[model samples]
Target: MEIVLLEDVKALGKKGQIVKVNDGYARNFILPKKLGVEATSKNLNDLKLQKANAAKVAAEQLAAAKELAEQIEKVSVTLKMKAGEGGKAFGSISSKEIAAAAADQLKLDIDKKKLVLPEPIKTFGNHEVPVKLHKDVIAKLTVKVTEA
Candidate 1:
């Protein structure tokens, strides 16, 4: 029997996949458990429409991310931190702080999780930070850390 999987089966195939299984297995386990449905013409058409819609939405998101990346690249964020002797910073700046600064200074609402800092900002100077806006989009932001 040919079946369209509604959900993943560990040994067989993932959701949205078409797989051929024995008649007894499809009737007893797959159909009864609602893990898959018979590969009817209507069901196949519905899957095709769903996949097209998903692809369209994904493309829109990628375009939006690219636009945001352009804006982000032009803006610079300034962060103030407490410093001790010899111009050393007391504590390092975090992604949350950077996101807050970007929001407050540039009016950009960036998520802290998207800011990728290899190491915390411990020095009082200018630095470039990479912000991942999307899977394929990365924006480089200039951050200036000054003594408060």
Candidate 2:
């Protein structure tokens, strides 16, 4: 008997997969546990429709991410910090501060966790920060640090 998996079954198959199992196993385990349903013509058609819908949604998300990346690349956030003796910075700029600055200055909603900062910025100049907007989209944001 052919079965359409509603959820993953270890050692058998993953969700949305069609697998053949013995009649007794299908009736006793797969059906009773609600892990899968008998794969009829109607069920197969439904699966096809579901796959098409998922593909459409994923494409839309990718397009939106691309658009956001473009917007992010054009933005520059300016932050102020106190200057210490011997040309050293009194305080360092963190990812949280950068994100807040962007939100306040440019009205951009960037996640601090997504900002790739190897360490707190301590220099007083222009810096390019890489922001991971999506799985495939990485945008560079210009940040200008000035002495207060």
Candidate 3:
């Protein structure tokens, strides 16, 4: 029997996939568990429409991410930090601080978790920060740190 998967099944298929399984398995596991439904003609048509809509939304998101990446690359964010006489920061500049600075300067709301910082910055200088906007899109932002 053919069924439309509502959610992903490990080692089987992903969500919205139409797959063939044994009749007993479909009736006992997929249908009862609400993981899948019988792939009737009406259901298949609805699935196709849903898939198309999802694809359109994904494409739009990708385009927006690309535009945001371009804007981020062109702008430089300045952060002021208290530094010692030797030019070392009192503490360290973390990704969270960078994210807040970016938000304040660029007027873009971004999560600190999305900021990819391999390590916290200790010295004051210009550094390139990578922002992961999407799985396929990465934006490089220039951060200039100066003594407060």
Candidate 2: residue 52 Cα off by (Å): 0.9
lDDT of candidate 1 over 1-148, digit per residue (tens):
9999999999999989999999999999999999999999999999898889999999999999999999999989999999999878999999999999999999999999999997899988899999999999999999999999
> Order the candidates by TM-score, highest first — what do you get?
1, 3, 2
- Give the TM-score (vs. native) of candidate 1: 0.93
Q: TM-score for each prediction?
A: 0.93, 0.88, 0.91
What lDDT does candidate 1 reach at residue 127?
94
- As for lDDT, the candidate ahead, 2 or 3, is 2
Worst 10 residues of 3 by lDDT: 83-92
Of 1 and 2, the candidate ahead on TM-score is 1
Candidate 2 segments whose C-alpha is farther than 4 A from its true place: none
User: Runs in model 1 with CA error above 4 Å?
Assistant: none
Candidate 3 pairs with clashing backbones: none
